[model samples]
Target: MYRLTTHSAIAEIPAEHWNRLADPDTPFLHHAFLDAMERHGCVGESLGWLPHHLALRDGDDRILAVAPAYLKFNSYGEFVFDWSWADAYRRHGRAYYPKLIVASPYTPATGPRILTGATPQRRDIARVLIQGAVQVAEKLGVSSLHWLFTADDETDWLAEQGSMRRLGCQFHWRNPGYGSFDDFLGAFTAAKRKQIKRERRRVAENGIRIRRVRGDAVTESEWAIFHRLYRDTFDKRGGLPTLTLPFFQDIGERMGRNLLLVLAYHDRNIVAAAFNLIGERSLYGRHWGCFQDFHSLHFDACYYQGLEYCIEQGLTRFEPGAQGEHKVSRGFLPTATWSAHWIANADFRQAIARFLDTETRDMQDYLAEMNTHSPYRADALPDRIQAVS
Candidate 1:
């Protein structure tokens, strides 16, 4: 027998125990990462990310499965677009806020939402976690339950659990055993490769030097400067930032090597920085901010720097956040991303199902179109690199 329980914080579960169920490749789902988000006021009931963590325990109180979850009031930090769905609900006089979401908050990178150990019974444990989530949603009377940016293997299970599958696209760069950034460029078309070279050269000609700082090597003062630039970007867009300065500081301490910054300096002064999180096999470019904009500093500090780091570090993949059609030209190719949803109300469920059906077709067509404009040389691309979806 298993008991399903919910806690208001990730700290409720021991990090050692929680990490045991987490996907080793996804550092974003680690206990310290989620706890840092909560302890530093980045996410909480007040901030609209009320932690509602789920766990499945056996008769002897051994944890068998866990889900990093939240009671979300609005979809601000979530990269998966669902604002229009909320509008649809409101138009029909239905409440959409305070819904249940199982995800790495604000992270669009794909991994498991329901984490299970390496036991042979892992499939059964996953089933229990999903069923428990549905029961909790019904008991709480929420309108919907969402699992965002889930890994591909979880899709069939989620669909079997009565969730509608949705397809989205994000640009990602895959390593093809390149020994250097130049080798990476060699695979691209001559025109595109020249364009990339010009972008990097322009940043250098503008008197900017970029450095990669990892973890504590980044001083408290520099982190402050980074956050100021970070907030400045949000201020320009009239947006709110979910992660706070203390939050970044805390993760920098806890995650150590997993945290890094691609910092850009102009005239010996800090002008911009791109914050990235590292995993065993991937580098995730999550945040970027600049005190001032230069001709091509963003591409240099964000995309090019990350690609270089991935090759140098022997990482297999680089995900540069969500929804950047512009990233396609810079050697980041179109990659399919997935999310799943369970709508409670039947009528609304049908409406969303119809919408997703159409959206999926549009997304597939768009991905195909984007591929036709692929930046890599037609003959240079490996089949695995070109055929990813």
Candidate 2:
């Protein structure tokens, strides 16, 4: 038997039980990560991300599966970009706020959505959890439901359930069995190679030095400065900071080694910083902020610094956040991202389906054009990578 309930807090669910459902390889899905978000007040009713997490319990009252869900009043931090869809609903005199979102708050990296036990009944558990979302959407009379930045398995199952699928692209760097940073750079074309070298040189010439400190090396004072940078970066753009300083400090203290902080200093004064999360095989470049905008500083701090770290650490992939064609020129390759949605209204559902069909094809074409301008040599491109566009 399966039971459903709205979780008031992530702590309401035991950490051990939640961790059991998550893959040990992906730390972002772990209980500590979600708990830190809520515990630090980064997510909750006040932040417009009310936790309505779903769980499947067995007859023995053991947690079998789970999904991180939220009741969203507006879509801001979600990189999946659904504002136009919301606007269309309003144009047609429909209410679009208060939609149910099953995703990681303020995170766009794809990972498992449905966490089930490794037993014969696992598939059924996933189905039931998905059905729970649909039922809840209907009961609440929300405009739609969305499962953003989900892994391939979740997308496949949701598609089978007739959910409208959408495709977006992000640039990610993959290690191609390179032994060192130099070896990795050798794969790039001659001109692009020289360009990267110049950019790194510019950072050094500007009296700025970059350092990578992980885990315990990140002090509270460093986090406070980084938080200010993060807030200023968002505030300057006329938006509110989605995360709190305490949240960063908490994650750094608890998941220190997994936390990679790239700091840029000028004359021993920190001017900019980028915070990244290191998973088992991938590095997620999530946030960055700088007090001053030095030439080529953003690229050096965000892209070059992260890529070099990945190569040195022998990590498999580096996903430096979302939406940057400029990253492609610096050796990041185009990769397709998936998000699945279920609109409660039939008319809106059909309309979105029609839009997605055309959008997917256009995205494919855009990626194809991007490939022709890749920084890598033709011989270095693997068959699988070549077929991405």
Candidate 3:
């Protein structure tokens, strides 16, 4: 028999135990990353991200499966945008603030939601974790339960258990054993390849030098500069910069091997930087900021640098955060992202089910449309798509 338990903090579970079940390819799901958010005050009730992680324990109290979860009071950080659903609930004189979600707070990259090892009973353990999460939602009397940016297989598992599957899309670059950036670009059509080269040249023409630095190699002063850029950018854009400096510092110390910072320099000073997490098989682009805006600098610092790094590092994929169709033209292809929802209210559930069905069709059509505009040469298209898949 297995027992389900919820902890208000990730620290209640040991890091080794938690990470043993996590996919090494997903840095966001690492114990150090999630714990840093909690320890650095990035997530809390005040921030609408209260950590209420779920764990399934065996008879001897050993954790067999785990899911990083939260009781959200608002729809601020989760990228799966459920504001419309929340608004609908509000219009109906119902509450949607305290919804339960299984996700890495403020992260939209797809990975394991129900974490389990390669044991024979992995599937069984995942099922229990899902059911346990639902039971917790019911006991808490929350409006709904959501698993955001979940792995394709886990999303399927959630749907098998009656959760509503929501389809979304992200532009990701896949490395098909390219030896270098130039080699990778060779797959692109001549026009698109020239466009990409022009964009990279713009950064050089502006006297901006870009470099990729590992977390451990980054000095304290450098981190401060990057944090400043991050905050200033968010301020200018009128978005909240929730991840604190301390959080970045802590993660830099604890998970340095998994962290990558892309810095752009002009005049021997730091002007912009992109923060990313490096996984065993993937590189995840997270945040970016620039003190000086140079033409095409954002593309170079964020997307191009990430792509180059992935190619050099032998990483198979690069997920440069979420929702930028322009990335598609830059050799990144549209890939399907998913989320699963379980609404407690029967009426709302049925309504959401219908809405998702329509939305799913729309998403399907959108992905198909996006594919027709692939930047790769006709002869290279087959291999490129297969690599991404």
Top-lDDT structure, candidate number: 3
lDDT of each: 0.90, 0.84, 0.91
Query: On a 0 to 1 TM-score scale, where does candidate 3 land against the true structure?
Result: 0.98
Cand. 2 TM to true fold? 0.95
Error of 3 at 1 (Å): 0.3
Candidate 1 Cα errors over 4 Å, as ranges: none
Better of 2 and 3 by TM-score: 3
Deviation (Å) of 59 in candidate 2: 1.8
Clashing pairs in model 1, backbone N/Cα/C closer than 3 A: none
Worst 10 residues of 1 by lDDT: 380-389
Clashing pairs in 2: 215-256
Order the candidate numbers by lDDT, best to worst. Answer: 3, 1, 2
Candidate 1 global CA lDDT score: 0.90
- For model 2, the superposed segments whose C-alpha errors exceed 4 Å read 117-122
Better of 2 and 3 by lDDT: 3
| True-structure lDDT of candidate 3 | 0.91
Relative to the unseen true structure, what is the C-alpha lDDT of residue 132 in candidate 2, on a scale of 0 to 100?
Answer: 78
Candidate 3 per-residue lDDT over residues 1-389, each given as its tens digit: 88999999999999999999999998899999999999999999789999999989989999999999999999998999989999999999999879999999888898888889768887778988888889999999999999999888888889999899999999888777889999988988999999999999989999999889999999999999999999998899999999999999999999999999999999999999999999999999999998888999999989999988888889998999999989988988889899999999999999999999899899889998888789988887646574323
Least lDDT summed over 10 consecutive residues: which range in candidate 2? 380-389
